[model samples]
Target: MEVFVARSHPVDTHVGNRLRQRRALLGMSQTDLGNAVGLTFQQVQKYERGFNRISSSRLFEFSKVLDVPVEHFFDGMGATAVAAKRKPGRPRAPEKPADSDLNTKRETLELVRAYYKIRSKSLREKTRDLIIALARD
Candidate 1:
């Protein structure tokens, strides 16, 4: 007899990362997202952490609320992440070193929001150029 142990799929993690990125970029809180989808914030957290697999209908609802296409959640997912499905009673694939996803960071989101709030086109360009120059050092 085989037992099925639930594990987070790499695809799910990728989708969750995208979900978090989009939500944060739009300045939406987990509570805000939950209320829009009729779920609690904890449920939203679980979804964002890939602990809960979102249903297709729920995903559609999220897409609608987030003002994104349904395909957005799968953006940037590699073929290896898609192919590494977990089987019943099988150990999950070893996690690869993830590239630093700046979009998923709260600091990055805050910085982006603050940058847009500058409101002057030339000032924004100067700020961007300054940051790029600083990064090159």
Candidate 2:
């Protein structure tokens, strides 16, 4: 008998992070995402944690539910990770940016959600301008 173990790939982890990021940005709970995807919240959690790999069909469904393109999940992944999957040799370390943590912050997500909730386009633009000016200062 042969035993096999499933390991989480870096790409999978990156996809999961993107999933969580998109979900959070939409202010959707795991239960909300699960209901839309026809899965339990626990299953959603598993996917977000990279404990289970998501199928292409499942990812497509998620894209529809999350109102994002399927490419969204792979947005920030490095070329090395993609090549690593195809080559299937020793895992290469992911190249992470120093400011990567900024994008994953709860405060950043909350700010983005709040910013998008402004109904008026002019107001949104003005808010964006204000933020940019403040950031530059």
Among these predictions, the greatest TM-score belongs to: 1
Q: How does each model score on TM-score? A: 0.85, 0.81
> Local error of candidate 1 at 27, Å?
2.1
Q: Which segments of model 2 are wrong by more than 4 Å?
A: 1-7, 85-99
| Residues 1-137 of candidate 1: C-alpha lDDT, one tens digit per residue | 76677778888888888888889888999999999999999999998888888899999999999999999999888888878867767776567533376667778888998999998999999999999999999
Q: What is the lDDT of residue 135 in candidate 1?
A: 98
Residue pairs in clash, model 1 = none
Over 4 Å off, model 1: 1-5, 96-99
Tens-digit per-residue lDDT, 79-124, candidate 2: 7667655334444564463237576677899999999899999999
Q: Report how far residue 30 has shifted in candidate 2, in Å.
A: 0.4
Q: In model 2, what is the error at residue 107, expressed in angstroms?
A: 1.4
